[model samples]
Target: MLWVKSLHIIFVVAWFAGLFYLPRIFVNLAMETEAASRQRLLLMARKLFRFMTLLAVPAIVFGLWLFLGYGIGKGPGQGWMHAKLALVLVLIGYHHGCGVLLRKFERGVNTRSHVFYRWFNELPVLVLAAVVILVVVKPF
Candidate 1:
């Protein structure tokens, strides 16, 4: 169980790194007026998205294992885990949203301003803060 938890933390960090950086790529993609830079950023975004998604699967699987196998939140005192899971679900949606944006950027059809993407990039930071607090503080 300890090993599984350790791996879960590793993959979660990996996945969050991708999420954090990918939007910055989008910020560059949205700002780059040169075709060469656009192509390079597009390629980078695609590969990062793929690799991060791979990390996400195992992170989620291990989380589910912790929940089901260890019964971390099934009892009366661990309501924080439920909120943490809800936040994780929201993060998954955010991840999927990034994929949609990635496709839009790939096709050269992205309409959002680089400023918009700069703002968008802050979102995961907030989520990460909330999740870490919920888990570490276990505040309900």
Candidate 2:
């Protein structure tokens, strides 16, 4: 169980690294005027998105293992677990949304400005903070 927890933490951190930076890449993509730079950023975004998805799969599996197999938060007084799970789902949606944004960029159809991406980049940080608080503090 401890090993599973450790692995979950590792993969989650790895995934979050991508989540944190992909939008910054979008910020660059939105602002980039040079075709070469745009293509380069697109390549980087594609690779990172794929890698992050790989990391996310294991993280989610390990999380389910802890919750379902180990019963880490199955019983009463576990509202925090539910909250964390909700936020995790939100993160997953955000990850998919990043892919959608990347596709738009690939098609040269991106409409949002760099400023929108700058604000968008803050979402994961806020969600991460909330999740950490829910896990560590469990202040239900």
Candidate 3:
């Protein structure tokens, strides 16, 4: 059980690392001027996004396992846990949104800009803060 929890934490941290870095990649990619440079940036962003998605699956599954196995629901009203869960879902939505936007980029749509990427980069940090607070403090 402790091992599972540790694995879950490790994978979650990896996933968050990817989440935080992916948007920074987007920001850099958005700033590239030359066509070849932009294409290279796009390829890097695509690969990073794909890796994040791959990491996300096990993170989510292990998180669920921890929640159920640890009997979080058996404790006092888990308002903080609920909040964290909601925020996580929002983060998942953001992940999928990035995927969609990346597909558009691959299709030569050019929808996102540096400003957009900068703003998007902040979201994971906020979500990660919220989740860490909720998990660590569990304040009602």
Candidate 4:
């Protein structure tokens, strides 16, 4: 169980590392004007999207092992766990959204400004905070 928990934390951190940086890459990608630089950024973002996406699978799997298998938050007064799960779902949606935007960037069809991506980049921070607080404090 301890090993599972440790692995869960490791993968979650790995996944969030990508979640945090991918949009920053988008910010740079949006701001970049040189054709060669844009292509380079495109390649970086594509590979990162793939790598980080692969990380998410183990992260989610370990998380499920902790939640459903270990029952970390299944007892009474676990409403906070429910909220945490909801946030996780939203975070997953955000991940998918990043992929969609990444595809747009790949095709040179991005519509949003760098500023929009800068703001978008802050989203996972908020989600991470809420999730950590819910897990650590269990504040329902």
Q: Which candidate tops lDDT?
A: 2
lDDT of each: 0.93, 0.97, 0.83, 0.94
Clashing pairs in 2: none
For residues 54-113, what per-residue lDDT tens digits would candidate 2 score against the true structure? 999999999999999999977889999999999999999999999999999999999999
Best by TM-score: 2
Model 4: residues >4 Å from true position, as ranges? Answer: none
- Record all residue pairs in model 4 with backbone atoms less than 3 Å apart, i.e. clashing: none
**TM-score for each candidate, following the candidate numbering:** 0.97, 0.99, 0.92, 0.97
Q: Which residue segments of model 1 deviate by more than 4 Å?
A: none
Task: Judge candidate 2 against the unseen true structure and give its global Cα lDDT, from 0 to 1.
Answer: 0.97
Cα lDDT tens digits for candidate 1, 1-140: 99989999999999999999999999999889999988999999999999999999999999999889998778888888988999999999999999999999888789999999999999889989999998899876
Question: Candidate 4's residue-wise lDDT over 1-140, tens digit each?
Answer: 99999998998999999999999999999899999999999899999999999999999999899899989889899999999999999989999999999999988899899999999999999999999999999987
Model 1, CA-based lDDT = 0.93
